[model samples]
Target: MALKVLSALDVAKIQLYHFKAIIVAGMGLFTDAYDLFCIPPIIKLIGRIYYDDKSAPTAVVSNLVAIALLGTVIGQLVFGRLGDQIGRRRVYGLSLSIMVLSSIACGFSICRTRNCVLVSLGFFRFLLGVGIGGDYPLSATIMSEFANKKTRGAFIAAVFSMQGFGILASSVVTMVVSTIFDATSDAPEGHTPDEADISWRLILMLGGVPAALTYYWRMMMPETARYTALVEQNVVQAAMDMKKVLDVPMSQIAEDSPLPSSPPPTYPLLSKRFFRRHGRDLFSCAASWFLVDIVFYSSNLFQSQIYHRFIKDHDPNKNGYQLAFRVARFQAILAICSTIPGYWVTVYFIDRIGRVRIQMIGFFFMAMVYFAIGIPYKFYWHNHINDGFLVLYGLTFFFSNFGPNTTTFIVPAELFPARFRSTCHGISGAVGKVGAIIGTVGFIWASKNQKKDEKPNPERMTVALVLLGVVCLVGLSVTYFFTRETMGRSLEDNENEDDD
Candidate 1:
């Protein structure tokens, strides 16, 4: 029989079983996106409803928002360890059930009395966040393990790119729901609507359906054969699985003398020289992610501010009085349109160009964009000159969706080895969450600090972004210096490096 040497592209095509694994990995990202983009509007809705006055959200409101985030902090550690121990499929499945139940409970909380509703929402949101946090580790691991070396970045990016889809979806959904709530009157109805009108329960209910249906979404995926082969010491079983995925006959499979049945790695990641060598790069990754939170999240949380500010300032319709619903709807539509395309870009090119170049380019330019905004802002606020802040803000959004903001999610998965994949992801995610916490809480502080001068406070935003730019520049350097180009590398390839 003649030997058939499949091209690299041919090597990339796994069986249906492996394709399904990518879907399962992506589902977790969808949940993560749902939690992320939806929360901003939902929190805004709470403000319009509960804290109609100029008051900070109560402890209940604050706690409710933080629950998922805090849950994520814990979930990363918990599921990360579990994924390594049990297998990605099991941990991933377990999380779906937990999330579905929690999301369902969140809907029912609409019946709660007064502040108690916040309590219920908080608890369940925390649970949802946990599942999402778990999703991050497992999804990235499975995708990385299964994808071909040449296109691993694109595959992981494509799978994770659903996050942008999820964000865009949330934006569109919130807009539609807001329109439904506002159909009765312009401007957020000062008074609560009838049971049907203000039914947050409907929104909550809709989000839960996916959680319930997630199992069907991930129906066909098997374990990562590479994980089993490389980490499990079950060479025969792993080989069998790999043969099925690659559509190769058993006789054709490589049998470079079987690896010894082995106990797992012994060195603590922090204690090992190999990891310690990479420590600064990892820290840079974590810190850059943290900085992304400060700007990226804060901008997203305040998306409504742009529209609301626009309508009130330039619109002839001070007479028409646009609904809060209308503002969000338009904004959501625009954001979704902008984000989805960029995600697909990741799907197509992450492997070809390399992750470091993407990160450096995105961060470098966004820094420039932020500086552009700062100059106009300095003129507009510091000089009492409003140089169309809203227009510049739109530009900021353009760059935000297109650049570093999205790449941050893709890089960590590529950079780390499987042994420390989750821990590294957790550390990066936790760093990002710290930024999110600030985006949520710190925004209030920034808003409060701004006096009625219509003056842009130089300290809060301008200086903050400047500092963020410095950090981003530092991240760019670290990426260039320490990070390797991870394009076209597979789990098997990286794993084999230890022996070499």
Candidate 2:
């Protein structure tokens, strides 16, 4: 039998709806980054307000960070499968609603005792994490399915790049809010109880606004033609929906036809056929993401500690507002200098240079940077050469978004069959979150053991940095051996499914 011709969606001209889809999906990612990274500074404020300590307990902070990641893992698995089983558009709005409600709950978290407050906050964050997790598979799959093959990589990269913006916004918002409160308060030394309480609540609650704004558009999105035809066996409806999105005439698709009457070969996710076809690819995606995230989440979340180490005469006596402002300022600088640009670079070149090549370059550069910083830690520290350290550190962030961070998300969404696309992406995302949990918890433990009066412990930080370099090298190897380049190829061509 001859292969069926391309459908309207596969060959559709790039149009305004493509950009709109990117924004609707991209905003969810923006919310994810803001909600996740914003917590670090607020956690510091929570400590000052509730416990009267400069930082929260190591165990408490670790839990606060890891619990949301845990929720994300579960949410990804559940929502990813549901997307395939039901439909992408049907389940898309549900996650945003979860985020809106949870963010509000987190902001309003209150209790009579410190422990109760912490517990309530963690609970809400976990729920928020679940919502954030759902966005991963849904947005990635939706964007990929909607995009034209010629520019799919760039479109997806554009969606992922919103994360950098989200991170930037978190820092900017924190700085602005803290500045306003500090200027108004009459308290000379530190944040008053009321000031600290109100500030943290406002920061958290603001995360919900973006997610809520995107909800109407998310509901209006039609199910992907690929999902409708392949999974639901509704080729006519799929054609109509694709016509709406692509703005092509129905006559253009009249010659195109449904898939074969004979069913495609079925393989359970854990079965041998599945492994033979996709096992290595899945392992490659999951493992590379796991490795990158260990450094990515830990380094980004613990920037406060890194900034404090950089500045000499770092007063142990600074007030809460002072500490929060400085951290936000430094982070904002890093985001502007390297983080945001890295994401856009990938968007510009992903289709031209290909995903695997870009990822390889990113990992190789990241490994080199980590080694440079780790081996010279003592020299950099003792000589107070923080400017040098900061440049190298910022380079790592640059390459990370430009490299494995973006590729990991893109590969899983593209490589798998539609039946399993969302599930596989979810699984890949969940694995990455597991690495995030380990990294966050491990860093807290490592940092806590260092003596208070000593200069930042170069020896201990050296070990962590070197380990990150090794992990990047491992990720590079996996990308070389297992992952395939997906640029300029239709989803049907990549999967080789019969279109009848």
Candidate 3:
């Protein structure tokens, strides 16, 4: 009987509520990406602002970039469990509130000493990260539950696809701000300019705006029908909620519909039965996310450095606003060329081609491209084939979005039971953040870039690329061996709602 209400959701015609849900859920991701990716281009600006002529230390750079990710790891675990225990809607707004306050706080961060200022910013970013982290499992689970099975992949992918725009927005926002500063505020050669300090703060504060706008709409959304019926065991309320969302006739869902003889048997996330049924899926999702993030985030957070190192177009003499503007422009172009398109393509084809195939294709091609670039890096470097190298490099971003980056988020939501759905997804996402933290922090050390003014090392870059390629192979292997196709399947069927 409870399954019947779920079936209505699985086959319900797409409507305004679905789109509303996407916007509300996806805006969180937009803010998340903005808050996160905006740091890359500004890391140098930050150093110049606070640390005088000396570039920020590698440790400082790592902390500034990776601290949010660490906070995300903690947020995912705590909020994920909370979503299941409390209603998704109940706690959803709280995450956004944290994001709103903390992002603003980041911009306003000030202290008497440089260390104190950086510390205050880090603390606020960590709080902001918690809000961003909570959005992951909650949004994915909410969208997956609300979507019809036929279009579920696209819907969830759409929610995630907003991240591409967020990344682009970060670059675009930074590019514009830096460009304005470049024109208006000129410091004498070798001195930090006042505009540089203002630019980064404005960019950080603006991330909260989109999130603040969507808070009301996010609160308006009801708890997912799956959660109401399956976890809370309230069939009438579940049916009532869906009746409004789907615009179904009340006759189909009686107000006094009798409860099931017994509520669906709940599986403890760590129990033997769950391990027997879903342990591999859990591992596959977690391991694949972990591997892909290490590659994905390392490149994402340090794209500025990577471009400056690999591309010869950068002027060594350029400093202050010119450097910031150039780096921001490069990142914007990269996002437009590769990152945005890759994400939209997944939204289009995910339901058509199925998740496993898309993931495998993405991983395989990424590995191939990494090897092609890494193995012959010196040849490209020496011959000044940076253009060709960039085209190859862009493919990694393209394939990443078209591959595991999107699917890893989608699969975990679909494969787990409603009772444990958000929790498991949070666990998977948290693990992915762990990989991201490693990638972001390890990248400087791995590239052997301890000093601020150091030139790129071909040997180190080659090793990093080769190692990332190996990680891709591992992700591919895990997907092929462990993940099952969830397309065209209802949530109930995917989670074996009938079995227990």
Best candidate according to lDDT: 3
lDDT values, one for every candidate: 0.60, 0.81, 0.82
Judge candidate 3 at residue 30 and give its lDDT.
Answer: 93
State the weakest 10-residue window (summed lDDT) of model 3.
310-319
Give candidates' CA RMSD values in order: 4.6, 2.5, 2.4
Clashes of 1: 4
TM-score against native, each model: 0.83, 0.94, 0.94
Candidate 2 Cα misplacement greater than 4 A, ranges: 1-6, 256-260, 300-305, 310-317, 382-385, 450-456, 497-500
Candidate 3 stretches with Cα past 4 Å from truth are 189-191, 255-257, 300-306, 309-319, 382-385, 449-453, 494-500
Error of 2 at 252 (Å): 1.5
Tens digit of lDDT per residue, candidate 1, span 285-362? 677677666666566323434533543322333211123344445456555555566566556656767676776776
Candidate 3, TM-score vs. the true structure? 0.94
lDDT, candidate 3, 1-500, per-residue tens: 33667877888888998898899999889998888778766776776677664456656767886889988999899989999889787889998898899999999988646888889999999998898999899999999999999999999999998998898888888888877877776577656576677888888898889889999988778888889988887877898888767787776655444555676676677789888878888899999999999989877423534645653224435555555566667777888999899999999999999999999999999999988877776556424545776788789999999999999999999988888889999999999999999897657765454353354455676787788889999999999998888989878865554545
| lDDT by residue for model 2 (1-500), tens | 32222356666788999999989999878988888768767766776777664566656767887999999999898999899889999999998899889999998988747888899999999999898899899999999999878888999999999998888888888889888887887775654445678898899999888879989999988899888777776667777778776778778765455556755457687588787778878898899888888878767433544645652114555555666677777777888999999999999999999999999999999999988877776566435556776788799999999999999999888888888899999999999999999898767654544566223355676777778889889989988998888888778764564432
Candidate 2 or 1, higher TM-score: 2
Measured on C-alpha atoms, candidate 1 has an lDDT of 0.60
